[model samples]
Each structure stands twice: as structure tokens, then as C-alpha cells.
Target: MAGHPLKKIQCESIARTSGKQCRAKGYLKKSGHYRCRFHGGASTGAITLEGKLIAYKNLKQFKNYTDEQLLIWIQNKLQKSSSV
Candidate 1:
């Protein structure tokens, strides 16, 4: 309730084709994955991108959350209704 919730399309879990676009239902389980099992959801890894545009985009979306916050966020069914 402390921050603004994100606005996006809710991925249709039933459709399968566009399921990844779902609002915040979130993917199946794994340590570091957020997408469904079909979309590399069980991978543990990180890659560094080299681009100011991409960097800014990431920063803007994740500016309020930390590594720890992300873990908690994911645990709570990817809920964006509250602050991360």
C-alpha cells in the first residue's frame, strides 16, 4: 500500500501461448526463476547486459526493490499490491 502497483497485461495461463504476459500470477517454483517452467523458469543464473537503455529500464523497474526484496516479492505470489 506504500507504492504504486505495476500495470501490465495478465498472462493467460490457460492459453499457453501468451501466458508469459500475465499480470502477476507468477510462474511455477524454482530458486531464481520468475517465469513459468516453459520459459526458463527453473534456471539459476545472471547475465550482464551492456547498454544504457537496457540498464535504465532495469533500474526503473527494480529501483525500489533489492535482492532481498525480490525474494520476498516472488514468495508472495508476485504480488504487486504492496511495496516490495
Candidate 2:
């Protein structure tokens, strides 16, 4: 209460279990809406082209891997699992 007034704004989302409004403080979004951390207040992922490429690369199990290498890795994994 002694800080920014926005800190007092509660999340607009509801609690799944309690079926009541969430108690967490909300954060302002780009769309001018406030959402809590557990709700829609989290990061919206990478935005810039370079950021998107980095994010996409992070999705791969093996970073910096070529398509053929990934295929080989997958085939090796499949073979090992089938042998077991």
C-alpha cells in the first residue's frame, strides 16, 4: 500500500480450485490489461527476429545440430529403445 498503486490491483483471473478471484497482484500488459503471474501476466515469448531464432533453437534437444544430425540422433534413440 505504501508503493505504486498498481501493486494493489488484483488479478482479473479466477482461482481454479477455490472458484474465486485470484489474490495475486496483477501486472500491466501491452493491451492495457492487468494479469497476475499465474495468469496471463507472464512473458509472451521472443519478439524480434533474432530472438525468435534463438528461441526456436532452444526448442531443439541438441542445439546447433544440423537436420541430418538430428535425424541420426532420433534414429539412434529409436534403435536403443527398440532393443530394450
Q: What is the TM-score of each candidate against the true structure?
A: 0.22, 0.55
Write model 2 residue lDDT over 21-81, tens digit each, in one string.
9878888877777788888746767665456445555665668776566556656855798
Number of the predicted model whose TM-score against the real structure is largest: 2
Q: Residue 48 in model 2: shift from native, Å?
A: 1.5
Candidate 1 residue pairs in clash (backbone atoms < 3 Å): 10-22, 10-23, 11-21, 11-22
Badly placed stretches (over 4 Å) of model 1 are 1-59, 78-84
Give the alpha carbon lDDT tens digit for every residue of 1-84 in model 1: 334446432333443566445445345354443543444445443333223333444666767776666555444633563556
Show model 2 residue runs off by greater than 4 Å.
Answer: 1-7, 61-84
Q: What's the lDDT for all of these models? A: 0.46, 0.71
Find the candidate with the highest lDDT and give its number. Answer: 2
Q: What lDDT, from 0 to 1, does candidate 1 have?
A: 0.46
